[model samples]
Target: MKLHGYFRSSAAYRVRIALNLKGVPYEHATVHLLKGEHRTEAWRARHPQGRVPALETDEGAFLIQSPAILEWIEERWPRPPLLPEDALERARVRAVCAIVACDIHPLNNLATLGWLKERLGADQAAVDAWYAHWITEGFAAIERLLAPGPYAFGETPGMADLHIVPQVFNARRFSVPLEAFPRIRAVDEACAAHPAFAAAAPENQPDAA
Candidate 1:
């Protein structure tokens, strides 16, 4: 399997964590988002939206969208499950993951930021402010929903924990203040220390150019 992704992309980061947690060995294909490689005709043919994390499965199927890719991973390899067995618990975890992926992440994606700069003439300071604002708001809700212990759900770093960690990584990159979100910070720190999470980090990726 080949995973097409940018090292710094949060969406790709989630997939990386999922792959590592599942102990899936796959070759990394670097798509340099900063260089606008994702928008190229070749990449667009594979992924209509020209996004990172278009996973070519071992069976030769292309899976796009981080959430869909994550669900696919969990379903294909059920051992050490990333989701809960109960439907209600699964829904709760999915809710938290969706909040970050659908609502907060889309608003802060590269295309959205670029549109703000190119179309709206948003200055660097304003753009940075916009990014941090969403991070703060998102973290506030996440902190509330998170359990008091290290990981978001409990001892294991499940789906919600995986999604939360990457968003916090982005939050720190954009200089969002995190002191207010102690619970969120605790869970992030714990996950960062785990081998799977550590190995899948952006800086640790081989193609972090």
Candidate 2:
């Protein structure tokens, strides 16, 4: 498998965590988003959306969308399962993942930030304020939804936890305060202690350059 990703992309970070947790061996193909490589025709051929973190399988399958790619990884390698077997448990986990993936992430993605700058004439401070506001609102809800444990759902880390870890990492990069969300902070801390999360961190990537 080959993963085309940018080191700082939160979506790419999520997929990296999922792959590492599943113990999958994949070659890295760094697509520097800052250099506009993701927008190039060569990269666009793999994912028309021109997004980072597209996975190309040995069977010649290419996957776009971080959520879909993660689900595929979960299905292919189920040992340290990310989703629970029970339907209700899975729903709960999905809800948590959605809070970050759909609600928070989309609003603060690089494209959106660029739009705010170019279209709205927003400065860096304004863009950062926009980012923090959404993250604060989203994380407050996530804190309420979390069970008082190491992970989001329960005692063990699961799909929701994987998504949460990267979202929090992004939040920190933007200087968002974690003080108001104790449960979310705890979950992120717990995840950071795990090898899977540690190994998948952006700073640990060989091509973080």
Candidate 3:
């Protein structure tokens, strides 16, 4: 399996964490998003949407979108489960994941930020504010939903942890004040200590600037 991704991409970062936690060995294909590599013809042929973290599965299948890829990872390797066994618990965990995946990340990803500056004629300060606002709002909700533990959903580093840790990494990059979200901070800190999450960090990736 080969995972095509960029070091600083939050979407790719989540997938890397999941693969590592499952102890799945795979190759990494660096997509330099900053250099517009994802927009090139080659990348477009490989991924129609031209997004990072496009996983070439062991069966020669290509997977896109972090959420679907995450679900596939959990299903393929069920040992160290990334989700809870109970149906109710699984729904709860999925909701927390959506808070980051659906609500927060889409608003603050590289494309949207670039659009704010280039297309909309917004300055750096305005872009920074845009990033911080969504992060703060979404984090407040996540902080409330999080379990009181080392990880997002109790002691294990599951699906929720995979999504939370990467988004927090992005938040810190934007200098978003996290003092208001202690539970989210605690989860970030705890996941940092875990080998899987630590290895999957953006800076730890080979393509990191």
Query: How many angstroms is residue 200 displaced in model 2 relative to the true structure, after the best TM-score fit?
Result: 0.2
Model 2, global lDDT: 0.89
TM-score of each: 0.98, 0.97, 0.98
Arrange candidates by lDDT, highest first: which order?
3, 1, 2
Error of 3 at 164 (Å): 0.4
* Per-model C-alpha RMSD: 0.8, 1.0, 0.9
lDDT string, candidate 1, 100-119, tens digits: 99889999999999999999
Model 2 off-target regions past 4 Å? none
> What is candidate 1's TM-score against the reference?
0.98
Candidate 3 lDDT: 0.91
- Whole-model lDDT values for every prediction: 0.91, 0.89, 0.91
